[model samples]
Target chain A: MKIIARVLIILSAALLVVGATMAFASSASSGSGGIGPGRDGFERRPPAGAAEGSRPPGFLPGGAFGRGEGRGDHEGGRGMPAAFELLKNLVIIAVIIAISTLISRLTDGLRPQRR
Target chain B: MKPEHRTYIRARSNLLIDVATFIAFLIATAPRLSGIGIHEWLGIAFAAAIIVHLLLHWQWIVALSKTMLRKARASSRLGYLLNLALFIDVTLLTFTGLMISEVALPLFGLRLPRGFLWRGLHSTTSNIAVLLIGLHLALHWQWVLKTTARIFGLVRPTAKPRQEVSQ
Candidate 1:
């Protein structure tokens, strides 16, 4: 269990970095495009050479800094429902708690067993 | 088992939670990184954990306040002031953050015409909170290191709570 917990933490940390990078890959490739979340929790960048009125798939009108959006998870019509967002947050909390527990437990393993 | 050892374990547990929540806060504060959905949820979770941290230290907080009121040491007074400021800043930050939330509430189709100012306020106050937390940690550096050592068995838990000599 301790090993599994450690693996979970390492994988989640790695995934968080990779996932965030991939999510931003589009906007990073596109000049002057803001990074925003897609409906499926991945990021959607402005399409290549998109004009003012034209938006890429899952791109919202205002983008990340726009008035209608504020670092939101889903975009336009493709977004996961709000209920799902809550669930995702719950999952995040669970993962964090699990990681904390596992770490403490692992340290507990190092302690001298009391008679 | 000694009662103080129990307190030591409990304190270490709370500190562990505090550290974990801080890391989560760091990740979720990035608008682009965590997206709206994750950031809002993380914010809520962080807030809940902060409350728990405060509660776990309630006795110390109360005792510190009494000492401060009774003209306690300057260090105790400073610590108390720092904690109070941190609490206020976090409260303000959380309230402003939720006010400008775009994903967490809007998922429920609840939209409030949050002012553009909320964005700026939330960012600035959060930065301040971060700084305050850093200072708080630095002030307790000895305790952090010693307690962490105890937790990892590099040293045994103190048989008695350390005297508040600095306080």
Candidate 2:
């Protein structure tokens, strides 16, 4: 049982690492083309006539960034009010880290302390 | 009989179930890979795995919830919260996934009326859910390992319920 547990854990860890790296890499390479309401890459060129801070019309899937999308869109985009596309990636990274830490602490508590 | 062993068993079982489900999910989402027919079958398989996984963990879920309600410990509360988020995300992923129409599954004579909102929701939720799952694994990595070891019979189960099962 112990051996199986160890193997599963190792396998899961490997999967986790591979999965996350794949996701991050895909997101990075695919850029904004995959989904979300933002530019097509890491750096937005900002369409012609669009101001630095102002998002152009039709920039997002639906006109007016948070207007018609569901909570998933809101949460997925990190709920940045749609105006701050620059902060979108940052928000996602932060959320991942925060959730990871919280989960770690909780799971840690579930296990009995080792002597 | 040791606590570490118990912990290992529990964790390993959960991980095994999760991995199985993950594979199914990957198959289901394959259609997204090339907009092919293989995706529909995969989707069905994925959904089945989800049901199985849920059924397997039903007892733990009930116990976890009951414990949470009784004492409201910070850890238990956090687990419940994460569980809730995961549930919502997975539900949305499955829901939205089914919403998307595919040419591959047309032969099966099964269809769901396509909804633009559903498609949008599905894509967005899937992205978020993937991230959440990653975080979930990262947080529980240690337990995941301990359990895997036990499942493989490489280590004995913990004698007590409270002992460091793994370094």
Candidate 3:
């Protein structure tokens, strides 16, 4: 029973972290975050048909986000991305605790048997 | 070898690993501190080392948690809780680090959203975590110094350097 509990704890921790990443990844790809023909993941589409190089597309060229910086959302400091990041961070800490606990358990087996 | 010798060796080994992991963690977690891909891989390495560190101290942690519930000393309880918080913060650091990751996770094709929100949180939380760790170390400052001294063979040490007499 104890072993089962330990396994469950480890499993949950890994799942929490992995699940958050998957959710974030899906959300990103679902948006304009794809790599298609000279388009990096974070390209902010110009309004309908705006002239090239007319306005700064939120991110500076060779700036923070994946590809040069798309529109406003692609900027590293606003909207869904930030919100998602905060959410994912909560899961991240849980996952770390779980993994660390599991590892600690393994080390217990190696200790010199004490009376 | 005598049991005392074994104890000393074990203590020294744990200390060495702890110090090494800490140095690596500082390098890995520092944003853009090591120039590009270097920092990313170091982050992954930090994750691996952290688990090992926990494992090395598992016995004490387990013993303390059990005792804390039954009215163990306040200091011991504080140590357990402090360590717990540190580990959790570390997990957060790793998790958010991945989301806004420009290097490590990206190679595995794990592309997260484009925003500095995770990045910003990562920076802020890390700063807080570092401060907490400083306190944690301060609580154990004497032990750290003595252990380092013992490892260098400059001082003779007991199992705990200073064994606590039971009340």
Candidate 4:
């Protein structure tokens, strides 16, 4: 059991290091162009014929739903609907929990007899 | 108490930890399911509880190596192995959670990384962790029940609590 525990710990540490490295590399490469709260540098300006200052067809600005579209509302981008985005996030969280729980059970079942 | 008795007590304690962890997980995830911020708050509370839980079992961890070296008990060994994995999984989940841009709640003005990879990994690991936790619970169903009955005073010394209560 100790050996197994040690092995698992080592493996987990390695994975964490790898994950961190990958994340760092990606961030370094993508710079400010990554998808997130801040504006990506690579994001292009609205194309011709697109309503000036109007959020693109699907994209809703972060504060859109909370404050309602004000007079300054103009720039729009193509993005998932707010409701959809929220739902997607919720679904992802739920699925992750479900999977972890399942794996835990499988591991428990593999325990040897204690008596 | 005899060695067996001591073993039973430790096992029972471990079982209680599992149940608490499971409940915490449920509360933490429920908000996400309903698409509400409540889940995020609950998750933070859960994380705090988990930290406490780990601290409480620190001694067992210290003795883990000695115990494993002294005995060839398979079930006990396997339990330890699973626990080790669980520790890792939970740690990753917590870290990744802090990486996501979304704030369920902010702490001391601290914010999680808003990078693309952080978000992606956080999402992926979260799913895997959930499934693993479910399996952990199912595998320890007996321990869960035993600990639950003990907590509720449903476990009797001489007979099953249900029978004693009814009589």
**Residue B1 accuracy (lDDT) in model 1:** 67
Candidate number of the best lDDT: 1
> Which ranges in model 3 have alpha carbons more than 4 Å from their true place?
A1-115, B159-167
How accurate locally is residue B25 in candidate 1, as Cα lDDT from 0 to 100?
64
Misplaced by over 4 Å in model 1 are: A1-115, B163-167
Interface RMSD of each: 15.9, 13.1, 12.1, 10.3
Q: Tell me the docking grade of candidate 4.
A: incorrect
Which numbered prediction scores highest in TM-score against the true structure? Answer: 3
Q: Model 1, residue B102: displacement in angstroms?
A: 1.1
Native contacts, share recovered per candidate: 0.03, 0.07, 0.01, 0.04
Q: Identify the superior model by DockQ, candidate 2 or candidate 3.
A: 2
Order of the predicted models by lDDT, top scorer first: 1, 3, 2, 4
lDDT by residue (A18-52, candidate 2, tens digit) is: 45533554465454452223321123334666643
TM-score of 4: 0.52
- TM-score for all models, in order of appearance: 0.58, 0.51, 0.61, 0.52
lDDT assessment of candidate 2:
0.52
Clashing pairs in 1: A39-A79, A71-B36, A72-B36
RMSD of each candidate?
15.8, 14.6, 12.2, 10.4
